[model samples]
Structures are given as C-alpha cells and as structure tokens.
Target: MHPDQSPLRARSAPRHVPPLLLDIDQMLDEFSRQAVRAEFRFDPDTPAVVTVEFLAERGPGVIWRIGRQLLHRGLTEMSGFSDVRMWPTLSGERPSSWLLLETQEMEALFELPTAELAEWLDATYRIIPDETELDGLDWDGFLLGLTGGPGVPGE
Candidate 1:
C-alpha cells in the first residue's frame, strides 16, 4: 500500500503495523518452540526510533527501541551489532529475514517476512522523510532539558 494512502498517515498519528506472527526458532531449545506475536510501532513525532513490542498472553511483554535506519538497512543486508542484529535469508522458500535479539539472560531468533517489513518501513519514510527528521525538533527545549535548565556553563 502506498504510504500516503495509509489510514495512520492520513490521521498524522503513530502507525502500528498489523501484528507480525513469527515462530521462535526452535534451535534455541530443540524441545521447546512456540509462536511469538510482535507489533511494530512508528511515531512520526519520534522519527528516528521504531518500537518493537513482543506480545505475551499476559502482562506488558517486552519492548525494544531500535534505530529506524538500522532496520531499513537490514531489509536488504545484514545490519546492527551488539544486542540486535538482522539479515535477509533467501534460502527459504519464501524470502524472509532473521532477527536476533540478545540480552544477558537469553537470546531469541525470529524469522520475519521481508516484503511486509519493507512495506511498513516505506510507510514510515513517507510520513517523515529521513532528510527532514530534525525539522520539527525543539532544539532549545532539548538543550534545556539535557542541561537541567538555563544556559551552558561556557556560554
């Protein structure tokens, strides 16, 4: 779907792409495997970040904030480092991407449909193009917030 035609874009609100159902790679534990549902949320107000929420049967679940550009780059090639990493896999019958999320306690791997993710990223770009990401930022307010009020010591 064209980004402009998206209902969320029309309303100028955060866009929540439909839940992407993925299967947790059984390689983590040969005996235990299950489906994991995730939702991708993009806010035009915070154009640089994309929030990924892993849904659970109960409670708040898990949330990860990732750089928007990192994900876009991952769609075609391997991207990210440290705790998060993603890469496209053409070996499968259906083109998909492998996303790895690692923490001190454990690591999880998920296969995502490449085309669907690309489409959603396109929509986010349409809402707020990369070049204009800082256009709406409040620089003065941001500085004040960062410095705990008033002018910088040097100035």
Candidate 2:
C-alpha cells in the first residue's frame, strides 16, 4: 500500500468525495457507470492546491494535484485546459460535474456530485479565504530557494 493510501492520510484530509467512473462506449453508443474510490485532500499549508488520489485494487494509487480555484469555478461552468478540464453537467436525475483528466497515453472521465463537491469546497474557503492565499508566504525565502541565493534572477 502506498503511504498516501494509509488510513491516517484519509482521516487527516479535510474532504473526501466519492467519485463515479463513467464508462463511455462510443462504439455501441451507451454509457454505464459505477462508484469508484478516490480520495480528495486539502492542506491548509498549501491553501491553493487540492490533491486527488485514485485508489487501485492491487497496486499503488494514482495521484493528481489540482488547483483549488479551478475546481471551484468548474462547479458553475467549464474550466481548465490541456491535461485537465472540468465542467458542470445535468444528466440522469442528479446535477453532477464532469472531470476530464488527459495524459499523453489516455484520458479518463469521472462524474462528481456537484452539491457534495461544492460543500466541500466551501469548507476549504472557510479555512483559508480567496485572495489571501499568499498572506503568510515568505517571499525572500521562496525567491532564494528558486534562484539559489537570489537578489535577482540572473544576477
């Protein structure tokens, strides 16, 4: 088991949304879906990032770190670009959201319950509000780490 899949890790996360795997059969023109286990983690120390781990049955889980803002905005409308995209969807009986994760090898689509995700996102905001994400960041230390003792980028 991967360290990120430990019980303690899941218990420590602020929110964990149960995800559904949408199986799209384009050749047959049919759509089938089932529940899948995935963990969503938010760290107050990195207020702007959200971590998602897709658990596997016999191996380590797949992890992706997404921007919290992008997920929040996606609840209402389409957002994201390139490898990640999310948009609102009203299908079946529930108003859910569609998350598209693309890589060079393949792409996967998951259906997320909008209400639950929105509520979870709201809780994150209460912990660290928007626009104040950088309130406590140490700029000098960050720059120094980036440039290896920096006064300027090239100097």
* Global lDDT scores for all candidate models: 0.78, 0.75
Best model per TM-score: 1
lDDT of 2 by residue, 1-155 (tens): 57659777666635433343332211111366655666777777887888888777679978999899989999889999999888888666877788888899978888777777788778788768888877889888888978789565566
Off by over 4 Å in 1: 1-27, 30-33, 139-155
Q: Name the 10 consecutive residues with the lowest summed lDDT in model 2.
A: 20-29
Kindly report which residue stretches of model 2 are placed more than 4 angstroms away from their true locations once superposed.
1-30, 143-155
lDDT of 1 by residue, 1-155 (tens): 67559776566744444444443342356566567777788877788888888888789879998888888888889999999998887776877777888999989887777777788888888778888977989899788878878765545
lDDT of 2 at 29: 17
Which numbered prediction scores highest in lDDT against the true structure? 1
Clashes of each: 0, 0
